[model samples]
Target chain A: MSRPAGKSKLVRGAQGDWEVVIGMEIHAQVTSKAKLFSGASTEFGGAPNSQVSLVDAAMPGMLPVINAHCVAQAVRTGLGLKAKVNKKSVFDRKNYFYPDLPQGYQISQYQAPVVGEGKVLVDLPDGEIEVGIERLHLEQDAGKSLHEQHPTMSLVDLNRAGVALMEIVSKPDLRSAEEAKAYVTKLRTILRYLGTSDADMEKGNLRADVNVSVRKPGAPLNTRCEIKNVNSIRFIGQAIESEARRQIAILEDGGKIEQETRLFDPAKGETRSMRTKEEAHDYRYFPDPDLLPLELDDAFIASIAASLPELPDEKKARFVKEYGLSAYDAGVLVAERETADYFEQAAKGRDAKAAANFVINELFGRLNKAGIGIERSPVAAEQVGTILALVAEGTISGKIAKDLFEIVWEEGGDPRAIVEGRGLRQVTDTGALEQVIDEIVAKNPDKTAQAKAKPAVLGWFVGQVMRATAGKANPQVVNELLKKKLGV
Target chain B: MSVDAATVRRIAHLARIAVEEGEVEKLKGELNAILGFVEQLKEVNVEGVEPMTSVTPMQLKMRADKVTDGGDAAAVLANAPQTEEGFFLVPKVVE
Candidate 1:
């Protein structure tokens, strides 16, 4: 149940059923301060060329040196993915021409990469699926090219040029859009947990290239089209669906699928061909003459391995085992690093399930409604813990806890102090609750007689009593007192 | 192992080199000679040797992850063919 499987069924098309196969090549910017080869800053949104170094600009006679921190970050990420760290890997030059690539070629790993085969356990709604990783490599990123900024000219920004990027490639194990989405999502979560990359799709720190191909069910893989640079997970899903349908249409129409790179037009919900003037698809990769093969010893691998943090998979398991939360709740909470930390802080010394419920159902729901992330959540974890404490100790009824939460969300205050200052505590005193219940029972004599006949009618009286008490009456006490008064 | 006339033109085009129609035949002969000479080096029988990417045995040097070199837009773009507002301007290239 927790293993990787292809869940995508064959799509029934005009002629027959077709299967969609997808693989991903994710380019994640390394969470580092400088470029891969120079001291240039890797900060986002800097002034154009401000972060560019002479080496990054590719001035004549300039050389590139590896950034040790970036290498360590990549190795850490590979270890987190359970990938094998290659003892020696060579840097190769992928030659091409583009205005953004002033160097006329990009430094990439072709013949050998730093990391080898591994598997990432992706959690889907149905179950956990493992996505096979092909390899992870280190490369330098090209600069940004803005084409629409000028009518007849383009502008280039080299701030991102020469920045370190981990090209994590996945085996063609995906079978559906949902699986692709889950794979990218789980990969992003793992990256965030490892602290290798910020993994923010919106910030362009993480991008994915999706490969989509369709064939008759269970047939050998067919011609696959590469969709370049789909940024968001939703777009990845859309791209796969559109590309699969297009290929199926082509195959049904007896037209061969062209193996070429295409782009996903998100606004139009379709993919268009990137028709470029080129002679065969040739990148002419060769070993970079300037850099030597990277060699990592056992000590180096062990050091990075020791520094590894508990990733999402282990964290989810620990959450379920330690906090006794539902597997679903643990999965949800541990999907992101901060949410898990938030849950741990809020669940400390409290009813763990109760805390999990409120954190997931109440707090997360509110955060989603407010369109905010847990990092920016206004409600503090400690406040949540305090609220749960209040509910657990019967200091406030469950209904009053919501009001308390809203009050804290809208305006900050101490939960205990707010309960005291606003007189919002549950009416747990037996005399007061009984008095309220007696009044309710007296007002509804017919209903009270009915309650005597059917004990279930006691619920109506409880609701009436709670409504009369402004939802602050302890429901447990109210139920007990009402049952006694009804003599049922 | 050998270069043809068409292959010479294609190689010249890929390298963005401007070669004349009359020069293609000469360039092809020269390229084939170079390949033939390189092929002769393959005759060496020594097998227990290591492939080297560099002339030295020093490991690849790595620098600290620090912002110690940038922040000079003018110097960075000093040799650009065109510039505006700290960005390099070129003929529009769209994908």
Candidate 2:
């Protein structure tokens, strides 16, 4: 990981420039069928309290049991992050009181999390930045307290209360919001690729708690304020920017910054103080008595490592090396798993550069306009591959290939059938092109004379020949024949 | 690790327990006695021993990932103090 030296991302304050430091604690719900400690279903959008189990609701005499699949998923995630998997980790009780938390104490990992230190490589325009992972802990999620359902009473939804969440904490290595967003995006991609978490922010499966603090250049770490539960990537960046500015304003006015928790109001584009340091809860954390320490053998870790799929970074490098693609194009194509797979299947035994160009430039551009993901693309990889083979074989001109692409996109069918049905193949025969060039040369004697004077004027005759052939003429043949007939 | 009256009051407030003024001294004494008993373990000087979280020395019980329960909303909400429209009604929690 290379950091561009001496490039300071600082906020200009009333006094001087201040550098803002950012770290994120992202909570991604693990992909599983049941809750972490209970056998209740973990489906989303269930009726209020419908998914609550006896253990989840804190009923009397209900002892919590750890879900084996959730543990395996967390271990797989830890390996994917290149983090240390602790053999002996304990579950601790984080005591607190809220309507959402029925147990009055959340079962979480405190001193001994399952995953130890790790690192994520975030790709930026300048270079790569490595964000250090502090730890990854397994914890149960709290229920939802709906305040709007009633005028004076809150409704509690326990569907998500006992769901398992993996809290991935990053070191304060990010200096800008762009780096922060990239970090989250890369992390989410890795999780999705691992099949550990879906990481859908819209469904509340993923959320970020952003920590923002500002300090002068080369100064010690200052007091940091945590912006809690920022759901979207766009809003995470906005929250960091606004929180850093708020801290800088305070420090510039000779006021000491206090460490506290704040909330980001997306509507106002500002962060307001939710709780001060004085009101901060002292969560008396102690190991839970009901559960024993998790012990994993070497075989378990090895199995998980063997089961890991090829990650984005590895796939991008392979694409660059195997297909001889540019680094930028490879990065773009390999950013999403489905897109990369699509490109690999399309580029097989065909013109790799042409396949890459079609996928990146034409297909991506149309997909963007239509607001559809590559998974829902109208054009299949096999169809695109066939079209590229046609272009490579010289059966269709590049212009004809574009028209064919449109036909295949709007009206899905075999590319060969469409090309045969529409008679869109290129006219590469010199005899056919010669007659058209002759007609154009006779019609435009003045342009022909200009072409004879300056060879650059040959483009005019080629344009006329192409127009006469309805853009189906081979452009290279048209240029050659036009120059021969016009005596350029 | 010492528990005083003021500390007991603060803890009660943090836990949202309604501790009366007359009960503060008794609660503090009771908490201090509990802590006093726990402190005796520190004198044993078990320097090389691991800190134990559970009484039983075994791995945590793992369950297969299956949704074997849930979907009975009425039975799940049967014990709620107040129910309205299949939801547990509590005091409005303002964030």
Candidate 3:
């Protein structure tokens, strides 16, 4: 068995090619101030039990009341995914035994999820492809268990318990690991735009359980392995690559794949099958008796849709049309909402093409090297706009702009103020430039004679004038002055 | 539609209840009797009505997104059988 036919990401086997089917269930923490069913704070990095309420601890006779903001966040996420929002959704109890989960059952949606089918347009290296979203349901996260704290006892932190999570399930539409990565990227961008979730993978807000399976070309999807503990996007791709190959090896050896969950070990770069459960999965799902069914009206959903921010796809298209940016550059700029906002702020009332170059090639490049996010940049977006305006207005040359950017990045001062204080303005004066050209021509007569024959040699004279003035002379003015003086 | 001995034991096992071999038959009878009473609800003709998620005639009451409670770790972990440093301590169950 190999991968799928899409983008020709087929896995080669000993006998023939196989297709790998990939789906994802992303668990994104809902950006809320309180837990789903309690008034406990949802702030990260609080004391272990400081943020947990009695309802979260599953105290006796404690009833669960839903948090309105969490439900709105879930709706906002579904709307951003361009999915159908079910007017009515029920919360069911998923019964299981776990020390981390104080309640024997988890309050989750099983049959009827809040969000229905949706589609995400993933921008792959080859081309753009659409991945179908199966469903997105709201659930509570379990507590964190630390076993290294004690030798024979595990310490459980309930701070994260009862925190709301939107499990966005994707269809088996990704054929390659690249597609998987792009899908997550696009989804995260949309979530950030909606302000529904922080979508930070390192913070455990955005986690994924990737389902990988391999089959023959055009054949039915075979047994798939659900890989959990994938905390980062890089690990998501590696898990898929190794899991696909593992399935291929098994099928080639005439062994049928077992449908079970596995854990990805990034340190080892392989997937390990989880220990078999002592008992079978019997989640006796039923409606939660503590809470009533969630019923949403048309106006509520319409209001959310109306207030929804512009997503990555629409922003990228606008950047291409309005800013005259290349599709690839637009994709990169619009991948993050903050970056896109910065681009607009920098490009406004300036040379947009030059702004794109400055932002993508210069500002972003420097930011990447500094290992800081745009929000933490020393140079503000308005300051960048000032530097670009200086270049466009001939106040400073492009070379001087680099120096100005470096000064601003290091010292955190106004770009215009730094340029003026440092006297980095361009020398467009024709008289001074002519005098400088005369000195260069008088010094290099032999070279001047050669330049008379080949006007292409005028670039050499322009360089000499720029250097004499410490790279402050305007090249266009110097070029014309040199031609008239050299008679070439 | 009916509960078998195996089904009864499976339910008991999932609920983390220890049932003897002889108790399986007795539990099956009890489960069947309870299911019989619930099965009679199927005799009523109630089409087009949505499944009742709650007996009360009201939508789910949702609280505002505010930190109105919590911050007393002592009270939160008071009932725990074993706790240390404001964390509930349980037998190590590593996965």
Candidate 4:
């Protein structure tokens, strides 16, 4: 079979080019105080079983009661995704037996999910692309089974059991690993902005099950293998690349791909078969006998929509329009909710593009090196605002602002106070600057005469004056002073 | 499809129930009988009735979002078959 016309070029293989189709099922823990169906705490790092309630532990005759706030959070997330919130959705029992699952069956949505189709706009290097979300369902988490805790026995931690989770399934729309990574990054940003979940992959709050398959270009879709529970974004890309190569090898050798579940071994950088479809559980899914259908009112959906904070995309657009920032700068500032808030606070009623330069170029670069988040920034937003104000008012040179930033970073203090204490103010006084320029004019008569003749040489005198005054001279004032002294 | 010996064995294994070789025949018969009984529900002529997940005509009971339970380690560990250092112990699960 030949490759499809108008489709992107497929990955080159030994025999021919092969197309890879990728989909992701992301499980993000809902930001809530208690479990989905119990009063137990959903806080991480709790002692084993200490956070478990009777319902979570599956005590006989203990019934599960849904957390109202968790349901609302799920609705909020659906709205954030621009998904359809199903007014009526049913919970089913997915029958499986695992040591971590105290109940033999997990309470999940099988047929009717809470949220319907939606599309995510992934910002790629070329441009923006849309990834379709098939459905999002509410489910309960299983507890942790730790085998490393004991030599001959496993230990169970029930703290995470029954916690609310949203399983977001995507269509097979991703064309490459880079697109997959961008899709996840955009989804995480949206979720964090909605305040529905922290979506911290490091904290185990968000993880993805990646499904990978490869086909002869323009051929029918091939059987897929799911790479299970890849938590980190880097590993997701690695998993896809390795799994695609594996599938291509199998297909080139005239072997059909088997449907299976595989584990991505990060250390080995390969995918190993965890289980084949023949060994998979039937998971006889049926409506849960305990819980009734979840029916949401239009008013409820509207209330959640009304309460949502401005999401990343909207905030980015506003930053570009109102702040006159570059698309790249707006994207960087709005990537995180905290960073966007910080930028808005610092840029409020001021020169926004200048403020953006400081926040994006200076603050973000420092934060990345120091391994800290914008929330843990050494300089406060108000403090940076003060520094930007000083620059705007010409009270301090840009070079002096850098020195002032270094001072505030090391020793916390008011920006104005630090500038005043260290005598870092700009030499905007044209009289004092003119004296310095006059002396330079006498010493470099030849270069001064050349500067008067060829206006480009004026740059050389500007550097000389700046070096003499230690870069504290206001650049515009220095230019005016040099023009007057050189009689250019 | 009718229940068979291999299907019965597989179901038993999935449920983690110990079904001996001698009991497989008996268990298959019992499961087939249950299936036959449930198959009769297809004969009901009600076309427009909504499928019911619960017997009661009520919505799910929702509780306020709060951590009002837990914190009693001893009470939680009381039902465990074995425990050490405040964790429930079981056979090692390598995967």
After superposition, the stretches of candidate 4 with alpha carbons farther than 4 Å from their true spots are A1-10, A276-278, A441-457, A481-488, B54-56
The DockQ scores of all candidates, in the order shown, are 0.83, 0.77, 0.82, 0.75
Q: Model 2, range A1-488, lDDT digits (tens) per residue?
A: 12322355677788877888888999999999999999999988877778988888888899999999999999999999999999888899999988889899999999999999999988888778789999999999999888887999999888888899999999888998888999999999999999999999999899999999988877888999999999999999999999998888888888998888999999999999886545666999998988888899999999999999999889888988999998889888988899999999999999898999999988999899999999999999999999999988888988888888888989999999888888888899999988888787788888877877799888777777777888889998888777667766
What is the descending TM-score order? Answer: 1, 2, 3, 4
Q: Candidate 1 — which residues are off by over 4 angstroms?
A: A1-9, A449-455, B43-49
> Over the stretch A1-488, how does candidate 4's per-residue lDDT look in tens digits?
12232255378899977788889999999999999999889998987789998788888898888899988988888989999999999899999877888888899999999999987888877777778889999999999999887899999888899999999999888877888899999999999998889999998999999999988666777899999999999999999999999999988888989898999999999999886445865898998878888999899999988998998888889899988998888988889989999998998888999999999888988888889988899999998999999999998998888888888888989999888887888898889998888888899989987986799999998888889998888899989888877788
lDDT of 3 by residue, A45-103 (tens): 99889998889989889999999999999999999898999999989999998988999
Candidate 2 chain A, which ten residues in sequence have the lowest lDDT sum?
Answer: A1-10
Per-prediction interface RMSD? 0.9, 1.3, 1.1, 1.2
Per-candidate clashes come to 1, 0, 8, 0
C-alpha-based local distance difference test score of model 4: 0.89
Candidate 1 interface CA RMSD, Å: 0.9
Two-chain DockQ for model 2: 0.77
Q: Judge candidate 1 at residue A332 and give its lDDT.
A: 91
Q: Residues A337-419, candidate 1, lDDT per residue (tens digit)? A: 89999999999998989999999999998999999999999999999999999999999999899999999999988999999
Q: Where's the lowest-lDDT run of ten residues in candidate 1 chain A?
A: A1-10
RMSD of each: 2.1, 2.1, 2.5, 2.7
Q: What is the TM-score of each candidate against the true structure?
A: 0.96, 0.95, 0.94, 0.93
Clashing pairs in model 2?
none
Off by over 4 Å in 3: A1-4, A277-280, A434-465, A481-488, B36-40, B43-45, B54-56
> Which candidate tops TM-score?
1
